[model samples]
Target: MTEAPHNDPAEQTLRELESRVEALVQFCDRLQEENRLLRQENEQLRSERAVLSERGEQARIKVESMISRLRSMEQAS
Candidate 1:
């Protein structure tokens, strides 16, 4: 078979640079996906917090009403 062409120094450097650029592109894509997932999780947590706060308020009102009824009974007696 005919001899293969010898690789020159410039050609080798170009190949190495190209490989590094490809790795950087892949890393950027992974980071973007992670950021999107985190944003979604944050929104979900906010919604849950709002629901819990409303439920707490309802419980407080119910307890206060019961106490008022008990106080009236004690005064009547």
Candidate 2:
């Protein structure tokens, strides 16, 4: 049987609506993936920052100790 061509206005409208909804769903999925990756990267960066901060503090303390030793030697001389 030959199928009739779809010429109904309501059917056309529904098809268009379905197309738009599908596009929106795909866009939302992409955004969610991007958000998840960004959060992971942010967490990694924060952890790196904490490690760097600790190293800096430790270096500062070592430098201060050396300065104190130098001052004592100078006073003895």
Spell out the clash pairs found in candidate 1.
none
Model 2 clash pairs are none
What is the lDDT for 26 in model 1?
A: 94
Look at candidate 1 and tell me the lDDT of residue 19: 97
Off by over 4 Å in 1: 1-6
- Please provide, for model 2 over 41-62, each residue's C-alpha lDDT reduced to its tens digit, 9 standing for 90 to 100: 9999999999999999999999
User: What tens-digit string does per-residue lDDT give for candidate 1 at 1-77?
Assistant: 96545587777788899999999999999999999999999999999999999999999999999999999999999
RMSD of each: 3.5, 2.6
Off by over 4 Å in 2: 1-5
lDDT value, residue 26 of candidate 2? 100
